[model samples]
Target: MKHLFLFLLTLVAFPFSYAQQAPFQDEINQFKQQDEQHFPPKNAILFVGSSSFRMWNDVQSYFPGYTIINRGFGGSTLPDVIRYAPDIIFPYHPKQIVIYCGDNDLASSDTVTAKTVFERFKTLFTMIRQKQPNVSVVFVAIKPSPSREQLMPKMKQANILIQQFLKTKPHTAFADVFTPMLNDAGKPRKELFREDMLHMKPAGYAIWQKALQPYLLK
Candidate 1:
């Protein structure tokens, strides 16, 4: 009877602890393993985020002269990015960082509110600035995927905060991909999305490449 009671107690406690700590531990472990190979203290442009970073098939080919490192993992969010920043981005000692995240968090319903997403972003930026004082941080506004189109108003709110925040700093730049990618109706251009309409097609990536080039070149 005593053993059964203890086991039941553990079961009740486990859920709360796992909810708080396990995901963070898993992200940290993933960061330690992945960053060593991709970053390695090289003079490179670090593309850090979730799937969008991972899906860039030919970043180097797009920008030939610079060393481009893709540090994107699928299904990650701002908290994961903060946990992995030292591994993936700072180790590379990047000249600039191109970041795209929060989309997955919104799409997965992992976050509670737009303000929660913005708070996470603010935390991420603060952490990066403190650790990498000289490196340029270029934030990519969350894209409008068909699956996540209903959430654009929230995204726009987040972007507005980003725009205002960047105005006060010189090293921080905001890459405004949202405006160009939108059609006259304020919807994402159909040509820019893949068949599922969640991910970007090559045509969409080309748009990013073009916008990113001038910022990096400078």
Candidate 2:
């Protein structure tokens, strides 16, 4: 009888153990708490994703008049965003959301395939759309970072899947930061990258600002 009880306990505990083993959840949570503290106003524009968005120190200045919120957390993946979506994004009731994520998921040691990345993206988009029907959604194509140059093919594949999905939604737009960042030789321009080669330099951010300006609400 004791053995039977123990077996059932293990059955329930196993899934929790598996689910709780997320190696990146803690870092993401810390970022979410920081974001909650700086919570943007309702009906504002939100930039949610990884380092590119997080590192945008003057995102609001780039798009003046529109109340913009930066919910970017460096080093987070799409799965991480979904895990903390309720706390990080849902409550704000943003008018629009500009997402730039998944690069870390592919380049990380997580072993997540391109297809898995695509599926997770669909899940994230669907969750947002269902919860915020009136919110406009814009996706920035995963930038071609000089540091992550080797991963460009996977990035392109992810962008292709996302772009196709964007086509079906009227309010959704895909901003193509990828093509302009590339040189005539079809490579990430070194000048745009900081010394780390992974993050964007001010020039890069300027380009991002230029690309983003037109889509913003007047």
Best by TM-score: 2
Model 2 segments beyond 4 Å from truth?
A: 1-39
**Residue 203 CA displacement from its true place in model 2, Å:** 0.6
TM-score of 2: 0.83
- Deviation in angstroms for 205 in model 1? 0.2
lDDT of each: 0.79, 0.84
Which candidate number would show the highest lDDT if scored against the true structure?
A: 2
At residue 171, what lDDT does model 1 achieve?
84
For model 2, how does the per-residue alpha-carbon lDDT over 22-61 read when each residue is reduced to its tens digit? 6556655675676668756788888898988889978888
Q: Residue 216 in model 2: shift from native, Å?
A: 1.8
Model 2, position 155: C-alpha lDDT score: 89
Note the residue pairs that clash in candidate 1: none
Per-candidate TM vs. native?
A: 0.81, 0.83
